[model samples]
Target: MDNHAITTRGLTRRFGAITAVDSVDLDIPRGGVVGIVGPNGAGKSTTIRMLLGLIEPTDGAGTVFGEPITRPKRYADRVGALIENPAFLPNISARANVQSMATLRGVPSDRVDDVLEIVGLSDRADDCVSKYSLGMKQRLGIAIALLPDPELLVLDEPTNGLDPAGIVEVRQLLRRLGDEGRTVVVSSHLLSEIEAAADYLVVIRFGKILFAGPLGDLLEQERRYVDLQPEMESEIEDLASVYTNAGYDVTIEPDTVRVVIDPVESANLNRLAIENGFVLRQLIRSNENLEDVFLRMTDANTEVAA
Candidate 1:
């Protein structure tokens, strides 16, 4: 068996005039939660649909468990997916709903109990789907996906429309699933949620992948800059002139001057300030968050594309 749970080479998809997924090459490994994050219409959905073999790619090829994505049946039984908001019979019990789907899939009736427990829904297993909260319903959907005890599980926008509490519930559930050694792929536009839930990340935008690697790798590569604030409110403009004279892209805030240079060079700014008779009120090195990094990357790419 291939070590990677999924791999794609030049995975491309087109919808007439628009290319929904553009030459994506992925080597997603097994046994960790991987988040595919991008803004809406960034081709996240289209990419995953190709991985699931629900839609054919326009140019490239991919595989699930080394089985060609073009032949989903080869690996479909080993995978479970919650492509979007899950649906269930509102009048039926959660157990019955799961059992019904399981029966249709030829999955054993006893698997329903096991999956419900995995999703923390055993206590409410018999509750009518109508009475379940959105979070509970989401868990029920996961239980449905778990019916086959798949080695790879894919969830699309799993926390969309959920309140904060619901988001936490799902985040914890993804962690639990990862801890059990299942390869889980979570798709979302929320970078913070992905940072919290996924060990690895594949960032996409405008139908192209921007970055793919361990989550820490991206954060570690975050651009670091110095935030300097001067003591005198009146000196802001003059202080900004100091860095501008030194060939830095300077941003002058209401009370501070920001230079787009490495934080390590902050000492030089301080020295320059003092030489120019400016009193430094505060100087701090800061790192941009992952969301900022991703946005900066995609936005830059957008400008280049245009």
Candidate 2:
């Protein structure tokens, strides 16, 4: 049997004439945290809905637990998900909300308290959900998702509206969950969160996957750059031109030159700077992080289309 917790083959969804989720493929292995990141309206939520079988795809197929997604038996027992804003009875306590979901899923009653503890809401379990802050409500939603103890957990914008402390709590919880060998798929627009928490990532733009791989591999030397500062302020633009003429793509910021140098060109940059009589004050190698790459790629794509 396939060990994948989630898999999609050419999944597509459309609304009238507009394509909300284009042909997209995803494979999430069991017992790992895979992050999905994209801009607003980039189809992250649409893709999750298709995986949950809440919306049928316009074309192609997907599977959860190695069975076709359309089959409730395939996904029902193995997957727990929180997509978009989760609803709750305003008058009920946080614990009560989780217990209701556990009951609906036929999960044991004791699992309610277990999930509350996992989400760190045991102290406030008796407080009415309406009285809970936004972060508390979000944790309650997570607690509901956890109650079923499924093989896979999928959360959409799980940290939305959370304060810094709440964000840290959720991040730690996800790490703990993954360490325990549960497959996790967390979607967010926040690159920092993904960088700090996810082992693997799928970056999307305009409903299509731009890259999918290990986070470390994606941020390798080829995709990195350097920020160069010149000792002489007057020679800043001159140094930038020197780098540019040597075929390095250099962007002049207010006081530094952002240089995109490959393996071969990177070595040449240092040697050329010394030879050209420009004193290099700083040469800090920076991984043009996923966020930077996302912005650069999308902007170029937009400019080209325009």
Candidate 3:
């Protein structure tokens, strides 16, 4: 079997005059969660749809489990997907809905109980679909996907419209699934959720891939900063000049000064401040969060396009 669960090379898709997904290359491994992030209209949905064989690519090629995407049946049984909103018979019980889906897929009905337990919905298995919360409904969508015993699970904004508690619940579930060695691909607008749940990331912009790699690697690429507040507000300008002369990006505020520097240089920064007669009231290092890094990348891409 291929080590990669999914791979695409120069995959492109166009709708009339608009290119929904440009030439894109992706290599998703067989285990762990990979988060795909992009601004609206960045082609995330279009790319996923092509991978699932719901839409054909206009150029290039892709494979799922080493089988050509065009021949979906070869790998379809091993994959499960939840894209956009999950549809269910609103008036029916969750169990009945799962049973009906199982019947259509020819999946054994016995798997329904197992999937419900995996998604933490076994207790409410008999509840009417309409009565379930948004989070519970999302869990049901995931349960339906799990019925196939898929090796690869694709979820698009699984936490969309969820409350904080629901988001946490779904995040933990995805982590657990990846820990169990299942390959999971998820897309979300929630950067913090993605940072917490995904081990790897793929960032896209304007229908093009901007970045792809381990989440740690992406974070490390961003410059760290030191936030400093002097004992006297008047010293802010002098402190900014000191860091600026030392070749650092300095942001001066009324109460604090933020200096973008390597973490190792933080001690040097403090030493210079003291040497310059600036009494430091507070000095704290702040790392760039995932949202910050994501915005920086996308913004850079936008500038380049301009």
Candidate 4:
């Protein structure tokens, strides 16, 4: 059995002069929540649409569960997707809406209630979709996607238009789904939301992938620095000079000098500073968060493109 839920090679889509998705390759491993993040117009949605067979690729090839994406019907039944807002009959109850969808998909009607419970909408199952909040509507969309009992679930900005609480709710729901052994691909512009929900991340910029891997691995690629505050503020520059001469990137502040180095090399940094007669007040590792990593990678890509 293939370990990947989704895979693509040279997936490209062009709109006359504009390339919405450039030559891109992606590997979405089976199980766990994978987040696809990109700036506006970075081709996140376009790539997803191609993967779901909603749009045909202009070039390249892809597979969902090892079935060719070009032959969508061959694998469509095993995958479920929620792209943009789910349209439901405004006057109908959530349950009825799901039932209609279940009917269309040939899913067992009994699974409607099960999906409703999965998305925390069982209590409001009788409420008309028009009366439901944006968050509730998103949940209903997810329930509909779940109706197929899909092995791979693809969601595009599932938390869009959601309030803070709603965002948290959706985040937790996606995490729980991944925990239940479903492979989930969730696209989002919000870095914080993805950090909280996803284990693996794919970051794209200007229709090209900037970074893709386990979140931890991406963070690890970012250089860790040791922040050192010396008792004598004037010694900051001298310490920075010493570290820079020793092949480390050094940033000097009012009372501290930050040197980019591995955590294990902190002892060497301290020794270098003490050898220069500068007493240290504090020494700590500055860990880069996901936002930092994302910004750095995307900004670097922008620079390269320029």
lDDT against the true structure, per candidate, is 0.89, 0.82, 0.89, 0.88
Ranking by TM-score: 1, 2, 4, 3
Q: Which ranges of candidate 2 are over 4 A from the true structure?
A: 226-246, 250-257, 262-287, 304-306
Which candidate number has the best TM-score? 1
Residue 81, candidate 2: how far off, in angstroms? 1.3
> Candidate 1 residues 210-278, lDDT tens each?
999999999987877777898988888889988898888787766778777788888998999999998
Off by over 4 Å in 1: 229-256, 273-283
Candidate 4's TM-score reads 0.83
Selected candidate, larger TM-score, 1 vs 2: 1
Tell me the lDDT of candidate 2. Answer: 0.82
Q: In model 4, what lDDT does residue 45 have?
A: 92
lDDT score at residue 304, model 2, on the 0-100 scale: 60
- Determine the backbone clash count of candidate 2: 0
lDDT value, candidate 1, whole model: 0.89
Per-model TM-score on C-alpha atoms: 0.87, 0.85, 0.82, 0.83
Residue 87 of candidate 2: its Cα lDDT? 70
TM-score of candidate 3 relative to the true fold: 0.82
What is the Cα-based TM-score of model 1?
Answer: 0.87
Give lDDT tens digits, candidate 2, residues 1-306: 897777888888899997877788888777878888888888899998888888889998988888887775667877788887767999988877888888789999999999888888899999999998888888888888887797789999999889999899888888888888998899998778877889888877777777677777667623767778889888889999998888778898778888876544555777888899988888777776667776776666556646
lDDT of 4 by residue, 76-182 (tens): 88888899787789999999999998998999889999999998899999999999988889889999988899888999889977888888888888998899899
